[model samples]
Target chain A: MTAALPDTKVLSPGNPPLSPARIVVLGQDTPFRLDSGVELGGFRIAYQTYGTLNADRTNAVLVCHALTGDHYVAEKHPVTGKPGWWNLMVGPGKPIDTDRYFVICSNVIGSCMGSEGPKELNLVTGKPWALDFPVITIADMVRAQRLLVEYLGVDQLFCVIGGSMGGMQVLQWAVSYPDKVYCCLPIATAARHSAQNIAFHEVGRQAIMADPEWCGGDYLNKGTKPTKGLSVARMAAHITYLSEAALHRKFGRNLQDRKAVTFGFDADFQVESYLRHQGISFVERFDANSYLYITRAMDYFDLAADHGGVLANAFQVTGPDGKRTGTPVRFCLVSFSSDWLFPTSESRAVVHALNSVAANVSFVEITTDKGHDAFLLDEPEFYQVVRGFVDGNAERRGLAARVG
Target chain B: MAGHETNGHIRPDLERIVEWVQPGARVLDVGCGDGELLHALVRRKQVDGRGLELSMDGVRCSVGHGLPVIQGDADTDLKDYPSDGFDYVILSQTLQATRRPREVLEHLVRIGRYAIISLPNFGYWRVRMELLLRGRMPVTDRLGHQWYETPNIHFCTIRDFITLCDDAGISIERSVILGAGERPLPHPAASARANWLGEQGLFLLRRN
Candidate 1:
């Protein structure tokens, strides 16, 4: 392990004990050789597993996380004391019902959580890698995940599932290691990054870079963090994660603290307060440059283009000689009706491609005002769909139903 | 069909069809919304089941429920599925909505050992009464949509379906008229009037 890297987990304050979460950290000794020529060696993946690995290990599910998510898929977050991103759909009795299938969720590479990222120091330089870290892509992220799974001795994953950036990883997993995944649930994602999404990411990048304190991504060493810039960046990206209807329902024309508008930049509106809260809370645990690298990776994701111009080719369910090795990746895509960032149209495009190949694919458009974050929110309908699907998959394998 | 389970133990018509499916039988269902029937077959009947569906929501729900369902328009995409990939092909309540029923039926029979099909009978008394007295499309519980907007592109009676099957050299293995849920009415004529003039036609067919 790099001397500059912390020996233990990223134990943040106010966070609960890791024991309650029971994350079995892997990748501590073997580093993944990245396609970018740089190797992230001695990396440790913090992950938690629910359920038994059935005799064949075919019942394991790989749960990928979105940009800011860590390995805590259904546990409580250590820093903010919040529940894991998809807790509503992934607990003992929940839809993903960890009781029936072995669920493994790890923090992605280039993340601030126990994973290796730019925020960690380089052993040679005795300084945080920061901008010195090699640029990674969504495909690279999936490769790292594959290594983690291989280390765990799981040959074929029953399913790979995630939403938004997590969904991007799910798609890459299916394409890059087709034989490993039996089913894929990529929610609120597109075949490729849209111009609009790219543009929004650009605005956030510019926000981070414009800060004088950013110091060419070396702000951490300078003891002068780019808090303002990163906060603004978070605020902007947060809006894209929500629908107009959700914002209206949550904030609307309501004032923040006082009765009337202060008529200044003092966050007079409730929405402003909410955004600021999101930004401030975000900056407390996240590294600004790590966000830059992860979002850039997402921006560069183009699954169909990588396989071929034909989107249908990505959905091919078989290898040469009609073998199931390269194919048999059943797909389930879910999109929220009000999610403007990655709307139902984006999901439909994926579904259409799967249809062209006559792939075993299913798509669900959850009727919710919660927008892109609906997958993470407390929506019973979304949970029901997920629970039904997960349970259904378990039953198909002749596995006895585990009481959730 | 008559000696099947009684009310409390009354099996869903789809389950009844699945119950008769031989173990390990490869089956494909058209317009399989949410794959409830396919899931049942795969789980209880131990059948290798796959399905084609149009609604993404249905596909998603079915897939989420862990069924092998593909999101595709059955009217045009049926040709893409491999021939003889299934022992039994089914088009339950979805045949009437297809743009070309005859073509789909032809494709279904050509691909499977047998095909199970069910459709709402349009010759039921309510439809006839609506056409004769009201002069408008009947919006009954079985056929719920208004005339111009319904997905039933090719409505047919039990007789029409039988003739098509016979003309295509397909033999009817079992045929029944179900009233309401699973109660069997008489023979072919029962399809014209049941459940106070609402009827459902089910057929188990085989290639001659």
Candidate 2:
């Protein structure tokens, strides 16, 4: 089944707007099966790699991106005309710098990007898969990425780093392949998605489905899009990403364009205009059906389920020799003070679990007004912490050997 | 006690503070669980290190981690550490929960070059609202444990902490009020809402 799929050469967002790292395709023809029993005759992964792979292949770093991010960790995005989401921290001289480590970022299987997703053609039906794509879990995403890593001829990663949903994948990578990852940094993430977070995602999905043009997630053929619903969904979700103080600072009581309120729902405030822009721009590159499927996948993520109900059991992983492990996958958990969605407490719970397993863990409570979005923005202190860690670790790896 | 070797992995917060220490500095950490900071200083910064901790488990853990630590209570063990042994006796976030902060401060100043202290600010507007309006101990992301289960014994406002530092004759050399990942915090309001708006406070001090 995996062999039937076509080549994936044009997946990179290049030229005009931004030059995002291109997705490198791999895999041979045999129906690649997912955890959900859904199979694809051919498989292609949209991936971007940075730095040079050493002869021994030990200096590779696998970075898993958040739900909305793509394979553009340090490059610019062509459609958005903006720098990569994490450009502030990953570059020639920055932490997680492309020059020192071979970094790989891939679009998840259920995403709207080059990877096979809800919009891909279904072998069973001659049309786009749409909602027919099998429900993929966070673990499934990790497994698919693992196969890609193997295809790249790499067996171990110097570090697995990410934040938010990407952080979840980092944790999965460490636990699922303890021998493969030397250091694990899962920032601003928890062992599992919280109930409140799941609730928020549900609201966004409902808002998208309620649009008159949704047509049950098959709006592509209707020549009409669920613009309003998708916009509202984006607006609501966007609120969760920012703090009240950040909003107040960015677009306080200022009016959209007029001095006084128009006394109508026509975006009277600047925040309204900003939110509308977010909604509109979001719909351009995103598909509403893919949003539904991806959010649902995040909602179902329960790391402890694979290792009984005890979260600690997940950390008590063994090495290849089955002895009590050395290093035991040390972790660093960072959380923002204003991040009401996942919050610092959620990160603490994960830290406690790591501590219970006697794993080396350091937790930081970085103060930020940007709320959950703090992870994406340019926070000097945050970057310093990351820079210190990455630089110190890189030195230990003797990356300096390559420099001189 | 076992002979110890230092691994040089200082806590990020402490890493920032170590740069301010004078040469041949002597330091003590109250509630110094596992002696990571002290061990790092001894190994990398060439400082004399000692720690007073209440938990036997903590002392043992520090011992196992190749750090030299004594299992004793911070509130009662100052006399054993002797005067002038430490040039800078540090209290990082342990000032709040001590049984006698006043006595601890007095003893800390007597035994070291100065006492570097840090704590969360209770006067932050959010804490006030949590107490006044929420009608329950506010469970924020920073202070997540329930009120009854919390380890914080001293709830000093930023103003209170500084005033106490002044009254104790501890001269403040450097202070940093850390806001979450990226928010900017002003120097004047460093103590006032740092507990609520910021995550923690770091200070360098000496006897006036």
**Which ranges of candidate 2 are over 4 A from the true structure?**
A1-31, A319-327, A401-404, B1-208
- Candidate 2, residue A396: Cα displacement in angstroms equals 3.3
Clashes per candidate (backbone, < 3 Å): 8, 21
The TM-scores of chain A alone, one per candidate, are 0.90, 0.91
Q: Estimate each model's TM-score.
A: 0.80, 0.67
Query: How far does residue B43 in candidate 2 sit from its true spot (Å)?
Result: 4.5
Q: iRMS for model 2?
A: 12.6
lDDT, candidate 1, equals 0.75
Winner by TM-score: 1
B60-155 in candidate 2: lDDT tens per residue?
455334343444566765644445656888887788778898888877887777777766667666777889997988787657778798887777
Best by DockQ: 1
In model 1, what lDDT does residue A227 have? 84
Which tens-of-lDDT digit does each residue in A203-237 have in candidate 2? 99999999989988788766688988888888898
* Backbone steric clashes in candidate 2, count: 21
